[model samples]
Target: MEPPSITSHLAPSGEVRDIEKAAHTAAPISDPSVHVPTDTVNDDGLPPLDTSPRGWLAVVGGFACLFVSFGWMTCIGVFQAYYGSHQLSNYSASTVGWIPSTESFLLFLGVPIFGGLFARLGPTVILIIGTILHVGGLLGVASCHTYGQIFATQSVVSAIGTGAIFVAGTTAVGTWFHARRGLALGIVSAGSALGALIGTAVIPVLFDRIGFPWTMRAVALTYFVLLIVAIATTTRRPLPADHPHNPFRISHLAPVSLLGHSPVLILAIACFFYFLGVFIPYNYIVVEAEDAGDGVRSSNNLLVILSATSTVGRVMPGWLGDRYGRFNVTIGFTAFSVVLVLGVWIAAPWRTGRIAFAALYGFGSGTFVSMVPTLIAQVCPDMSKLGLYLGAVYIVIAPSVLIAQPIGGVLVSAGDENSRDRYVWLKVFSALAMTVGVMGFVAARASYQSRVGKGKVV
Candidate 1:
């Protein structure tokens, strides 16, 4: 079946709601059993969108959930540097690097399953369980003194919670808004910027003031409170109305088969290469700077600088994406990221140069976590099936994060661990990976335009 034209959902006279609403009249609400629906699709068979109070509330819920999950995930560099000098210092960078890589790997690795679970169980059930596992994992990590203990608690169990809330919160927002989706999702995703900024800035200070174990305890408490708010606020759909089944049957969710679609296939392949090296700066900035004779404090400052710029990166680009086409804005920023990695990160070795690179790279890569879903929505066959399609895309790319971080660690060795490695090869590798990522997106754009045609909804 040919998918409904993007035009089908627009209001009369071809004006999108961002400007003028087409003639749309919502149903009467006199019957408590039959709730009124706004943002209804004209004839696409997709679920109606929600841009009302309930929609924004879902966005808030998404914001809190992501702050703990993807937000904290971005701070892995801070932890990596600290671990190298302190906890797992005895192990080589490659071996100790497995902890964060594994945690990142598991978090994304479980996205497909978690997406399925989100469809079946809804946000509250999934988030409640995620909170328990996540908080419990943090508490466990506090007492861990050995590599195995930390790996088990931080990488495995905690990662599940992190992935769960991320999927639940993200899908909730995805289903909520259409006209303002880029801006709304950007705001929801900015929660990660908040988390990354706070975590990067504060983790080092807290470590000194309270020590590692106590620091973990404090972070865990923060997670508990924020996650509780997410649980209370997020809903699967704007309700009094529920998805035909609040407890949906798993089989009804989009299946892995959707990956075979040409656009999705191309996009997933692109993400694989992009993700493989996209995190190189994030995973290695502190260590790379420190080895080059940048002091620990200076290196930490670089991390903060990167996170701070990411705040602007996430929101501003998204606002532009809403006004311009999402594809144009995303592709433009993505290509700019390739330039930053090669031109700035590779060629510049001075203190001033590295700081500049941090700010630029952070902004350039900021849209990725927010806009990938918006892109996915463009090609999705059905909105209700989005969770599975999103899972498929991310899972295809999960191995990249798993492999790249360890390889980056190995690349830190220039003949010996003690060598003042400049990481030339790693820089080239990251650029190349991101380059392939760009190529993939360009191809996906072509495929989507060919299939869906021009002037389609972004």
Candidate 2:
């Protein structure tokens, strides 16, 4: 009765009774074999899986998607230079400058919205839609004669499509690898650099012979082929039975929680300034070179060098981040960028130094892009929330692009017709922003270290 008066239920033998008492007082036993560790699983019940052959194939496909999507954006600088001289020559440099900047801004801003869509609709549907919109946007741009048409077709529609495809492709890669996530992401992200290199080398040749419309069409065709490969090869890992639906509820989209987090906030600020500065060189370097009378062919060659150098910089930094720590590597690159902007870009009085600056800035900026996402992954718990967080950051970043390119153009436009004062101002802004960005990045890294102790290791 009454559980035999708890103590009375013990075995008669003293040893057994003592053993039972000790067991009762001891901590609850955990079943090591049965309990899955948090470190071993994604927020989904999926176990930490190795990169499979199929996964590698998917990575290759995803790389192609990234290559086309980002490469196309990088090619915008070249387009801006060309269009500023040709179809849009009638428009002021500052006005025409909005086209590529708007496109880049939209590409960055559109990610979170499309990321949510990707989570719901799945990558296949999103990727297919992206392919159509991307190609269609190019075609639309090719047919357009006015600035409004170019903005509508190229800047808004195409950028949105590229953002969606990029989110899907990168997220797919994220889902497949954990241990190798940084390396995998780096490899895929490098596609943009590769695409830039290819575009820089090829687009100019096409522009000289086939013209902008045909060249874009050729680019569109390349995107189509690459997207088909991505769709066929890429896939999401099977989510666990208990995995939460990644619904884009208004609450999930609320920026307060992530924005309030110091690391994320710092990251957002860093990105804003980083974009503000980085895009200047990208948007104006060709123009500056041309202003210096480098010749159109030489301007194109400078872009090719920047693109090729950037390809290596993007990938190597990712691999280095895996070893040296993401934040550390990122800050290092950002600092280097500031120095290049000030020392190489600003001080350059001749063709050789300007070319050197282009190559240096390209490599440095590429490293920054490749490492930021990896750094973000370290701060966030749920991979599904990556889009929301990244999007929020870009919300700030988008405006920076909107302003930066135009301001650079205005600076250039204000200079004595041949003085290159615009470039001088562009370099000044880039250097200042990069310096601030590096500081922001350092703050972010310190926040990460404070929360999760240094030497503890990721």
Candidate 3:
């Protein structure tokens, strides 16, 4: 048999599907047994978008989850610095780097499984379990004494919980809004930037006053409260009223055939390369600044600046992406990130220059991070299958996130561990890696345009 055509899901009329009725009518009842039959296709094979207040509320819930989950992840630089100077001070930078690397690896690694679970068990169960694991893992991290213990607590335990929240929160937003997806995702993603900005500033203060253990406990408690709010507000598919399976079966989810689809293939390749180098700066820039003689306080402030600028970077691209194309905005920003890495970052030798590089690079990188998923959602053959596709995509990139920072650590630790010049090669490596990332995006965009025609908004 011939492979399936993605266009089959699009409306023949080429007009946006009116999902307002379904949004209002489907699953209005409080019964969990109700399953609303969704319009799986519209003019673009996107669900009928309901730009409802409730939908935006789901966005807020997602925002909260990301704030606690990814926000903490983004603040890895703080921990990297802390661990190197204090707890794991005896370990080499490259060895100490593995902790956060493992954390990132697990964060993306479980997406496929989580995606499968989201489709089967729904978001509520996933959110609740994720909240438990996340809170518990953080508490565990607070009390852990050794490198191995910290790895088990923060990396394995905490990472899985973060992944669950990530998959559930992001996919929940997808089920609600289609037209405003880029904007919604952007806003939700900005929560990470907000969280990072706040955490980077507060963490050091907390570390000094109450110390590491209580600081982590305090963060865990805050996460617990926020996750509760997130779980309460987030709902998947708004209770589909007529579905056959009361408890969904994994077999009923989107088939593996989607992996072979052109868009999926190209997009996955793009994401793999993009992620490989994308995280390096976020993970290592503060360390680089610290090594350059800024010391601890200034390095933490640099993280704050980077994340503060990233907040704007995260949201603005979403708005721009909605009007322009997501691919256009993403590609533009990804390319600009190359310049920031090669130019501003590599050339910056002083405090002022480094600060400028932090802000600009953070902003440029934020666009790529915020808009890449929206682009993926656009090319997805079925709106209903987005979680599955994202899961697959993240699975492909998980290794990249796992190794990117460790590789940076190796480069910085090359020859002498204390040499500032050691970081120059890492910068060069990131620039080269990001260059390949841009090429992947360009290739994917070209392939998408060839099939859909250049004029389509996607």
Candidate 4:
């Protein structure tokens, strides 16, 4: 049988076939869709997965983890708006921007360490500890009276907790699903959208009715209950104690070695630039609307529309990524975000246009946020080093996140608050940053395709 063609749909058999399939499947370094012929070794080298009830349950756990953890990230605009008018009104926009900026900075900085701990301590323990810190941080924030106090509680403590859950929760999903990894991760990403949709609406109501302190306490309580379910359900497949390639081995402590990989380097740069603008809409659209004289109702409604469309963006792209290709879909939508930022968001002069801008931008940027991680995983050469690679990428991207909103604040602060020109500059900056990021992604995809040859699903 003339050595089964590389593209043959035949049942994969023998070591040679496995090697060929893996080679054909490999696009670059991050996305290793290595196909093992036998139903024994999985792509990541774990034993056969139980993609059944127990396994699916773990995915649910991951969904819950992301929902709770990333709620604040997506709904940060609400907090930004609230602080601007209420507790921290005395502070400058640039100073207020630091709260969310610090949260993101710590979240990225801690991902590697949290990833490492997930392997060592497992998801349950790590999640439990994270839940405590997150809930406590919320309670602390409710009672906080000073800038320093809010910074310590909301920015530092709460952020660290959110980071721990984020790294562990997302990683747990991979343990259960291999072939459907993109879809699974995509569903998990939707949790953030759902959380934002619900949390943003709820926070405003609670603030109006119950006040900030009790509202936070109520939110914390809700998180406590959801976390209990997460702790119960999320789990991973353990490597056999005698397995030669121990993932928990000490030598794997640092992600430094991955810094040398060309794909990793390129993607890291792309991520840094891409993230520079991803959070702008999420953090500033409401404030921008308010400044444009849209009033509180219109501004809040825009956020709701953004959150709803983003949910679709997060879910649909994941399914497409699994069927088509992660990089193809991700790169396409990333470029689309530039158009939304510049064309839609920047041009919105009236309330109706602003609403339209929110929905369109939300959809485009939603995919941008949800699909990038899976794209990184698709290009990763070594499955064992996935966490480390993620860590390295975040390290590059974190500082951009730290400074992006604050810079937007500075831009707006530099000119008249009501001047449409000031906000226009912010949009221009966002669109350009995303455009540069798209080029980087295109370059990486093109470079990989050239090496692999055409007509393959990279």
Candidate 5:
């Protein structure tokens, strides 16, 4: 005979129900989707909501690390401008552009390895190694004068070093806090803007007064001292022995199974498109202005202005995202970026246009950086697996970041000067890429809603 049905014969058709509901009277049904944050538990724990001094210090260390690594990357426009006028003047724009392009790629490229090591070995050992490479690479650039020499030291060597630092800076912060993560990351990301401002404002002045060799030496020395702070302060809370992320089993790094999550796959593709041309304003604003018959040199200060606004962008939006939905705020900011690129960037007169776009776009684009980590947090329930999620996102976006920049350089070459027009194609390309990214975000949210039956976009 078959096993008796868990259900009972009911007096009315309406009384018939799931046997699980009948069992619920004895034991409540458990919801698998309800994730208890690591904060509730001790080992993973996030140090009791991360209000402690050590947690804040980790935030400080993350700021310093990013200031020296990724934040410093924002100033790559100055290098692009300088190379065109100086040592690498012989190379074509697209060819010369490969240096910063590759450097940007390398910064994100090492995340999976670095994230794994960070979870396994803790922040100290990996940070020390990153410090050596980053410091050594910058100092090496001081002696390099030829095309091959600069590319080797700055692009390949220093870039790989910064890549390591970027991972340590971001993931260290990730492991430290849970509830306040968006606010903490936003504060840390402001360091990027501060570094960009210093790099844009200070690097040019240093170049004018001291020349390249000594200028490089000064930057290297500064980075070494700051990196020391990061190594000392950034701390990772231990994950439980059984946690998949505790020792970060290399076998599970960048798990291919994550793509099975509909939201993650859609969002990753969206971010790739978003990043595709987003840096055009940062990397080529100075380059484009410099090529103009009108004094391009006058517009160099715009980068500083952009960085200043970027500081506001990074700090404020992150806090807002915590209060509001991360996805909602991010989508709004991204849409604004599309409007800024298409409307303000392409239409304005030379100097006025550059200034308006720089200030507005800087703030608009800055939110994307700060909010991304928070967005990724939603994809994985376990805070212990944060490193893996971060690695997956970056690895997906890295190749696009690598290629988009060189493509921007090529677009600059395609513009026409005699018509008093340039950067037209570049402007349209950037706007279109952002448009698709916004569409993807919308679709991703729709998918999330379909699965969860959400009322809000979050």
Candidate 6:
């Protein structure tokens, strides 16, 4: 039997023959006799689907844990402002300011190590322990008499709980959503922003009416309730019994490949600069208002406004990210931040300028935070490794968060011994840092686009 002619397969009646011919034409590009798996078949063979109600329960539970943990972390800015004036005024701004930043760093950086632990132990077990630690840390803070004591209890111990909750909660979310991953993760992450808004507005008002101790006690009570809900609902989905291995092996611990990959590396650098600059506004807004002749009450209200604006910033960008591409959205907002910092913030001479800066920078930076993890998700293929990767990134940037406030404080202290010109220097440096961050984001985006063109899977 003669082999079929290529043109013979072109007839409308020769559908099967045409498929055979097309297959034959492509065969010579590879091994002709070897059977290659179809893309659909390969995808079908992926890890089994999660269908259990328990899996979803775990997801909601995890979100609750996140709401509490991130809420408190975001509220640290409020606490920093409060303690700076009340209990820690005797200490230099640099010294007292380091406490909350350090707490945030530890809270974020400790996640991967704990995430690995959570992977090994059940999330439920980890979350329950974390809840106790979280409440206890806050209670300890309510009882603190000195800056050092507050640092120990609130910064170090509470940070440990925050880390535990973050890793577990984020991993839980990762486990639950695949197709709707970006939207689901966005909603969960929004909890932190919501917490910030609620905490800043509520805590300050509570302090005004009830006193700091009672304010903290109320926060502790709220956390206690949320943690209970978390424990009751949180669980891990059933997967093949592969004795939960640490997501990071010693080999894998050398820094994620994404860091080595130029795109993710640049993004990390951008994050560092973004954090360094953006936090200037967050840390100094209260102080700025006070310097601008606003009273403590008005300063606290500005912080509340920033927090509320940021809550909207966080959610809106996340929704836009789903449509416009995470990288594009991140870069756009980052650039907007740079402009707002320099133009509206640096050039404004009066209270109006300061207030405008707060609103604009608050919204811009909030959008940046909302989009970062989504961008990370786009670059990372394995959902199981999300926590590890995020943790690693935080570990790298932890120093930036640690130093930004103190550095800004030092700048302020140096410019005017009385701290009169600190806000000006803060505005300047913030603008510069954001400019660098935007450049880094642009480089990362270009790198990402290049990789996409190569047909390397995102």
Candidate 6 C-alpha lDDT tens digits along 1-458: 97543223222243334333333211111111234443231132332222335555665675677678876776676776778789997888788878978887877666656755654576777787787778888888898989889999898888888888877777776555443444555666667777777887788889889998888889889988987887787765444333223343653333454476566578788888887887777777777667667888777776677767777777777666655566777788888988887787667745777777777776887888766766665554344455555665666667788888888878767676354444677788888888898888888777765654433222
TM-score of 4: 0.88
Clashing pairs in 5: none
lDDT of 2 by residue, 202-270 (tens): 998998899878888888888888899999987765554544454457644334355766767888888
The global C-alpha lDDT for each of the candidates, from Candidate 1 onward, is 0.77, 0.73, 0.77, 0.75, 0.75, 0.68
Q: After superposition, how far is residue 1 of candidate 2 from its true place, in Å?
A: 38
Candidate 4 lDDT, 189-226, residue by residue in tens:
88888888998777888889999899989988888888
Candidate 3, backbone clash total: 5
Q: Please give, for residues 264-371, the per-residue lDDT of candidate 5 as tens digits.
A: 778888888898878878988887666654454466788888899999888888777766766777899999999998888898748788889999999999998777
TM-score of each: 0.87, 0.87, 0.88, 0.88, 0.88, 0.82
How far off is residue 30 in model 2, in Å? 26
Comparing 4 and 6 on lDDT, the stronger one? 4
Candidate 3 lands at a TM-score of 0.88
Evaluated against the true structure, the overall lDDT of model 5 is 0.75
**Cα lDDT, model 6, residue 171:** 71
| Positional deviation of residue 300's Cα in model 2 after best superposition, in angstroms | 1.2
Cα TM-score of candidate 5: 0.88
The global Cα lDDT (0 to 1) of model 6 is: 0.68
**Which pairs of residues collide in candidate 2?**
none
Off by over 4 Å in 2: 1-50, 251-256, 417-422
Model 6 misses residue 163 by how many Å?
Answer: 1.7
Candidate 3: which stretches are off by over 4 Å? 1-5, 8-48, 239-256, 415-420
